[model samples]
Target: MFGNDVRLKLKMACRLLGGQKSVANSAHIDNSNFGKWLKGQPTLSEENIQAVLTAMGLPDGEPDTKNIHCWNIKNSFLNNLSSALSLYFPYTAEMARAPWVVQGPSLKDTLGIGDAPNTLYALTDGKTRAILRMPRSVIIQENNVLPVIKWRNDTPEKSVLLIEEIKSGWVTGVPTVKEFDLAWNAQGHQVTDHDVLQAIKDADISNKEAVRRIKQKK
Candidate 1:
């Protein structure tokens, strides 16, 4: 799951920054090293992580000692700091705060396209966007609105199971797109991408789930 999280975060970051080249430059790492790092291998040092966080425009500070147990680092403070950075400066945050217009599919539809292949758009504020693809087989049914409580970020078991169940339902004739964001009442309001990504990460949902949930009531 850590490996998966890293990959998803990296992919989202790349999309937010416009391209792989931009991410590599912004993170101060080369393409080869970046690829390796995303694969759960840290070819760079701790300072490199700091540099990447800074590149992402997130707050980088000394680690906090209290929240160390939740992380896997020698310095609990730094670990906590890193986790906080990842949470606060998530790919969604970068995209949300970007200067250019970042656009993507709102979970219900793929960039206003039909839902046959079941792909989501990953757009930047700049003139760039990529398709965050998902398996069409995971969709349970279209227009299925599940409660948002089942999609929180603290419990991984429930999140993973819900996503898998959605996929299962999809395989058994459930829709691929499930509406999961009735929590928000209005449209065009402020919905932080950081919170969205964290929820997906904590819940172990795929990018498909992320886009689907956000576009529910809009």
Candidate 2:
């Protein structure tokens, strides 16, 4: 029986994780039931709560990942490329080589005394380190060689207006999208966030079942 605050978190989890169906599947609950329960149809259940939280990338016993943030640009663009590639080739699972990354507890938060101060990061691709915040983007910069759009040089003014809100460019020429596509086709994501979440849920369920069995035997 979680309150509105917890309920709101469940909703936010859905947004971050794509949607209700995605969350429901990972939690191993029916989509409709999951929606209703979070909506307070009959209130929340502890079992379902744990499943959902773990599916949303929270560790066991943790209330939520309010402080943790995770992202992967390759996945974001590859998802787009998947949509694009599907239009041309008969797409398969192998065609998609992206992982939904989930960040764990921060050392600063877990080990530090009080509130963590704001900090700017100059990240790296193991070779280059740069800080490119793009003025307003939440993503300061990922120093990896990634896609870029010469949106202004050759692309039409009408097209620029179409993607006006998109914050692209600053990487003059890294790796071409074509090369990225080729490499993506050659390899598949070994394990994905979905796999991790499902494994966490499965392990949790297995542990509980084992405990129940031991109790029954006793």
Candidate 3:
């Protein structure tokens, strides 16, 4: 699924940017190799994924785990999250009044909930929407309220929740979402959670400095 999504996204990127030739040049992979890679032939290394994303002019850096609303996970994770979100926030004539979906991964990997490699998604009702994703393993057993508090207070951009599923004495993380101020902007500037996560991923800053800078901007 990852390979397939990458291929489709690459094709879309090519068309958006220019043509096949331009995409080939930007991705630094020959057309034949690119085709092979897309077919699950394993032509490119994992490192090349970043190259493809960069060529498409998407964000470049480590995947953010905090915002969960913008973290890119494996395709399987995304599919599951999308299904769960649609279920939780079912679309109806009244709900369909708004017609846009903002999908992405979160900033933190496991919002202290169940396991690693959890993906996130956000859906809005024009004013605000929910931010949801799976949590880490340790978080599944401990008190969940702390992460919830952190998510609410520290993440001024939205209100969110951490979710986990425990069954038969075993815990499994699942996609979670909660209300957030989708239209809110910091410092009178419109910055999506993706933008903030990207900045955090790309910038080289200490914990103290990072906090100071983010606050200063706000």
Candidate 4:
């Protein structure tokens, strides 16, 4: 329901967030231009409007249709990760070694998603805080250690689904195709975005159903 009025939406969003600066940071708008927009000198672009909606958690608008889909992908990632962890049980403690994707200043910087002027997610687990190492990437300058969750007795189907969700999240929300390829390759996939996406799409059928049946058996 995002109508043709960019200024109105922006003003309302700013009020919702308490001010222009907060909205600007969340929308990834830099200071100078954000001031300009507030002053009515230059309006936001279509792409920027969508970015703002995504940042404001207002994905209910028409501009955020793709974002809604991306959010769903992220949720699926969390659910699947949880399922995998459940299977790992006594062997897998949610203690220190559980690797989960998070939104934060450090992660955004590490993932090369640009500065957002705030840390949206914080690692609060005491045990995880004791042992977490920032991921090393040849591309990303941030020292944020990559968190990798290790689990035993994992299935290929589960693995594929997990990666799919992860990749899809980046593809739809944050990273570029080249960035996606580089990140996954650094994680040792050695595959392009096209390759991974195709694999994800292919795995949507028999393999997933088979995994569901296997889980049911268990």
Candidate 5:
């Protein structure tokens, strides 16, 4: 599924950037290797994937694009659909669990979004995790004057949930407790439930109501 998703995205990237040759040149990847990727003659590498995204002027992140086949944006601030299309990327599942910084094209002038911040953090929790649980791509949009993310369901019913972005980027998916523990330990702070809750509060990615609900669930 990941391969197919990469192929699908690669084809689309090539089209948007011009063609296979253009992509190869822009990404600085060898033409033969690029062709091999298209033909499935060899396995796709992280390096090539990053190169493709770089050529496309998208953020460089380890987004699991393979699990996602389609993405649909609703009520986007950007007037140009093509420009909005560049917003989609396969973020790693772990990155999805917490807020992380991502750099991309300045979205300010494009739709009055504002200037590129010296640093910006993406929120990757709550509804973003729910969507990934369904194993689908997310739809990016704005709600209540904040960036909201939701699952892009491809079914006929098209059930979706729109939640505010963790900060800006949505989580790729949930992470295991062990992974969470490792992350906490790596932070070099004494681990405690209070500490974890405090960290979440400091991040400001999860809504107060949502956080309250989560605590209640626990």
Candidate 6:
């Protein structure tokens, strides 16, 4: 059986893309086989799981690499802020033992959350939640344990999201995260559904038609 988290996301993806048939077509799976995977009739193989996720166009679940010194785009965005901006990080297998906390404006601001002694946060833009994680070792805050953050308005160049310029840094994934960001410049998107591409899938309808349907009701 698929994990509840994966199944739930599958359900949402299917809903957004039109239906199971659409998702199956996008994943290049026969409709019947995809249905079986959904129902767990024979269960889904790991290889197929990756294929489905790839079709979903999500950031790959595995970090591009484990080298902590490497740079990451998503992590670069959280610098010089003051509030909570929790990015959902992946948990290999031990996540089963940890709790899931969803962050909102009241929680803080930004994305690309770093490591913690205990829990990891889940971040969603009402469509999909991108989980995240970064080693605490690479994080250097202005004060202490937490990552550094700044308001770009205070000093356009100083409050930048560049890691080299960060008073401190965080984790990363998905270069497209800014497109959906609701904070700061909101440079990602502020109107309409930002995930239209991922949502269109293989609906067999014109992309324009699908968008019309969504916008009319959206």
- Sorted by TM-score (best first), the order is 2, 6, 1, 5, 3, 4
**Could you report the Cα RMSD, in angstroms, for every candidate shown?**
18.9, 26.2, 20.6, 18.0, 14.5, 21.2
Going through the candidates in the order shown, the clash numbers are 18, 0, 24, 6, 11, 15
**Candidate closest to the true structure, highest lDDT:** 5
Q: What would the per-residue lDDT of candidate 1 be over residues 1-218, giving only the tens digit for each residue?
A: 33657555544544434455676797778778866776778676777766765554432532222211111111111212222334332332111111111122244442434434332211121111111223332221111112211112222222221122334222233222121121111123345878777788999989987788879957
Worst 10 residues of 3 by lDDT: 92-101
lDDT of 2 by residue, 1-218 (tens): 46655565556445445567888898898788788887777644678777877776553534231322221221221223222212111222111111211122344433544542222121222122221121111221222212321111122211111111121221222233333333323433356878856775777767577567658999
Least well predicted 10-residue stretch by lDDT in candidate 6: 91-100
Give each model's whole-structure lDDT: 0.36, 0.38, 0.38, 0.36, 0.40, 0.38
Global local distance difference test of model 2: 0.38
Error of 6 at 69 (Å): 27
What would the per-residue lDDT of candidate 4 be over residues 1-218, giving only the tens digit for each residue? 33325444455435424456776787787756766664566567767766666665454342222221111111111222322222112132212111233322345555657522211111111111111122321111122212323311132112211133344333234444344333333333446878755765677756577567658999
Worst 10-residue lDDT window for candidate 5 reads 127-136
Model 2 CA lDDT for position 212: 76
At residue 142, give the lDDT of candidate 5: 28
How much does candidate 3 score in TM-score? 0.27
